[model samples]
Target: MPIKQSGKRLRVPWRKKLDENGLPLTLPTYMAYCAVAGALRPWNRLGAKTIVTLVTTDDFYFPLFAEAARYFSSQIWHPQRYHGNVLQCSDKNFRHEAEALRDERAILFASPSYQIQEDDRLLSDAVVSLGPRSARHAEAALRRAGLPITNESVELLLTEPWSRLSRAFQDRRDALQAIQRLRSLPKAIPPAASEAESPPSTPDPTLSDMHGFGSSLIEWGYDLAKDIADYKAGIIPWRDVENGVLISGPPGVGKTMFARVLANTCKVPIIYGSASRWQEAGALDEHLKAMRASFDESREKAPSILFIDEIDVFGNRGETDRHSAYMRAVITALLQLLDGFERRKGVVVLGACNYPDLLDSAIKRPGRLDRHIAVPLPDAAARRSILKRHSGVTLCSADYEVFDMATEGMSGADIERLVRDARRAARRQSERLNSLHILDNLRPLVKLPSAYVHSLAVHEAGHALVSHEVGYANVADIKISRWRVEGEYRALGCVEYDVGADRPRTRTFFENAIAVCLAGIAAEIEVFGSFSQGAAGDDAADLNRATELATAMVGAFGMGHTLAVEKFSPNAFARMRSSNPELRREIHNVLETELERAKSIIRLQRAAHQALVTRLVDVDQISGAEVAEIIRNHRRPTVSLAKPERRAAR
Candidate 1:
């Protein structure tokens, strides 16, 4: 048979290099293969006289480098002469061999730790540097090689002598022996206490010790705390414990603080990792390595809490195309660590993210981060508690309530900032921190643009009027405060209402709610010549809610044009719109009808609306009772005078 040539050279981008199972290839192996293929190229564009390359890799991955060189030579280089072409030499004789090679393809793989003596030939244009493998690199390598080594495995490989021996020898018997030795290690003994020693007097704060959590949340925290206590007391096995929790909410809702408090309550040490810290390490590969190192550290300190902050960095895929592949691979590595081969017993992984919707579903699946706890923005009572906790001694119960009322729609962090600002103001004035100081500092922070105050008053007054007219008894309070702005949307004002317990709500109730929702926009248009985007956020939310309500009424509740209930998904309106176009039209029609009803109601209660708007603009806020009183006082005349003669005849 004639000698067969390998034909054109095969090249892979460093980022796209993968193993058979589609995971990222280890950095050393990837570098070695790329170097070998480059050296074997028919044309040496880099001005190299010889087709030989020197590659430096980590000591631990030296074997993988050799394996990669051989595999690439067979698959890419000339198959018949690959045996003679590929060479793995130590640094001891690398200098002489590299200088002597001429018109021959060769690859010299050496450990990065090896210090090669200065040689002219060794300092050639074909020197490739593959630095030492990191925890991330090892993970990528093991995954590419179809081995089941993870961060936990790395921890065991480092800590357990038998496990290390097993990995070194690649034998299960050695691994079993290592496990036996780990079990046989001697336990430590505590020193005897003196007679004067006494037990601690104070009660330790556990999950139950945490404040600001709701009754249900407190119960949940108590259960977790109890579980940890029981586990420590040897009353329960580690397997019976929940593995992890996912805390999600808006920023400054104390998600991070909650994690710290939970760890303290559980009496376990916490390992903190932030996504930005990992990204700061530079390349995606380095970021993965850092992330894996964090997990490994948590595993090493077993019976600990691992808190990964701002985890939404590994969000759902397909959001971007620029670095989609790189990001997806990173997420894959994270998923592997989260629900990998190892079953972590004592370690509890807690992740906190503001954008939970953006996170990958795989991360939230069972056996990984299964428990989801929402840390909501503090309510009035919670806000009061938070203010009292953060405020100086100058603030009393009355000041707390006033601060709480003023901080409506503000997060716990926002309140903390306000109190901090107040303290600074008091210190600057050399006086006690009082309500006046707080109010003065808070006014500037919560002040709205002068032009928008009237518009906001009109908007909130409209919602209050419509809600009251519709007999929605849960209406609590309405305010025109510029406390916080969410994303790109500015909050001019808001109307607070309670739905009054969970129950099967009717279509009439939904329609009434939709009317109240549109009342803000309607009121703005009625008062101002034209409505502004101040209600844009509310407009979007109301439209979505109306569409959902209309869809449910037609498809699920059978309360539409035809009383025929149909089984459909929640998003069926968009998917089945072409076949049943009326579904969308009816939804729009419902919203339009509600809008017109709101306009008519505002028109009928025009005097009352004006009174409410005036009070809101002047006073900045009004209680639900004040709103009802104004409406009651400005009631429109029910008896019309258009047919007075007919009434006299009767």
Candidate 2:
């Protein structure tokens, strides 16, 4: 296959090579095969001309080479003829065996990376670097081979390579058991940590850990948890409790989380299933067998939760689509075992799907997955609650209440990501987790229109120009983006500060930080006679940051009216400042001082400011070095970068 990358056509040479008969079956096998094949093209010619030997860095590629040799065992080395020593790993133990084969006019794969001097003779034939083991190369091979991979499992296979992947699966051909293990895990945790001497296993997730769920759905889940508890305790028969529920929601609303939590609450095991799991087996009979095995496992593990994700992928039988015949057969088999002659006894069925409308009508009939609940994206209140739930001590209720207004239309997934990203940013900064980190780390949702995009350029250009004027920090770069936050699309701007490690966190240092933060609004006042809410509209915006810095300067650093360190708490500070006019005046004076300083700088450097803004309006991004150069030279930016429409908008 020819893949076009960066204007070049690259050929991907891949064949199944050898993933059969007790050999590991995985993507790595194919990737390893690709590297070897690409290194030695025209397989037969290489075998005929010289004694082909692959000298490797790691012995991990031994099986890979053996499989390749077995596949291309042709001519004097015909596939059926050259059996065992077609490819021998020339390791320390097998050195004699490999040399013996070498003498007999056979190919011997050597370990030149280990001891090049000892195996110097083997390297003369051809020394090729094994580097085609890239996920991109392997994925192309997988697609051509028609190997089925789940959307979720693809990340685990590709992102976490070698150790985790090889441990999970060795090859894809005849890897039914490996596929089965991956299919059951709703969240695929890379299994590499188990062998690395980690801490003791923690307890499972319970009901309390789950949040942002609809009241009815959560209440139903809890009651079911209790009933399952009773059923397992022998206080009631399995038929007394509702047998199943169908939880439908958009992706990342935690559909599978419900089952895991409920199982934890009731102290029963949970087994995961999905249409893809059954469909992993290509043939109809094998698909049926896999489906039956999942059901049978649930039946034997009585009082267990059987959670089937992406249930809608089974598709509907009524529609006369091309795939109807096979699906109808699978659905019929599923329906029979779901409530068939052999009762499921104490199993609780929970079916999860992104689109409930796509599910088979029979799957949700009474006595099956009957109860249906729809989980929608969290609104303002729910988003606030979700933020608090995920943040732990990183943020408080008052902090969340402020953010609640800011994160109006975010989903449960988005909120979790917000907290996770904040933690990562905080770790990188070597600081304690703070609400500002969470707020600042939010990703841009969408690109903007022409009008707001121009304004963002002006706002960011101001910060970049003013930060350079201030000696506390230097502007690394400035960018404006069309940010789609909530349902609304608006322009947002950012200025990265390069604060040197040599700078001390003294009162002057913080005061400089405050001035840099205030530069945005100051520049706006200078250029447009007024600034937009882009400065201080939300709790996490520039105005808020400036205020926080000034507040910390006064109270935390003992720089203003009170020369006492008031340990910072965002909520407490907000409340204290609101109540105490004296403290408020102190913060206001500090802000006003920085504002006037920035405006004065803007007035003097108006040409540089306008030049940078014009360039930014054109390019949407500018480097700090170039920005400084522009300011230094006071040169007009080239008018070529902006579109005609953007120039008109400006």
Q: Please, what is the TM-score per model? A: 0.50, 0.40
What is the Å distance of residue 177 in model 1 from its true position?
Answer: 77
- The model with the greatest lDDT is 2
Error of 2 at 540 (Å): 28
- For 445-496, candidate 1 gives per-residue lDDT tens digits of 4345766777778888988888878766656678776444323344546787
Total colliding residue pairs, candidate 2: 13
Which lDDT tens digits does candidate 2 get at residues 418-527? 88888766534424467888767764344468877777777788788777766534667787654456566433567787867886676667766777787888888887
Q: What is the lDDT of residue 597 in candidate 1?
A: 84
Residue 570 of model 1: what lDDT?
72
- Give RMSD (Å) of candidate 2 vs. truth: 21.4
State the number of backbone clashes in model 1: 2
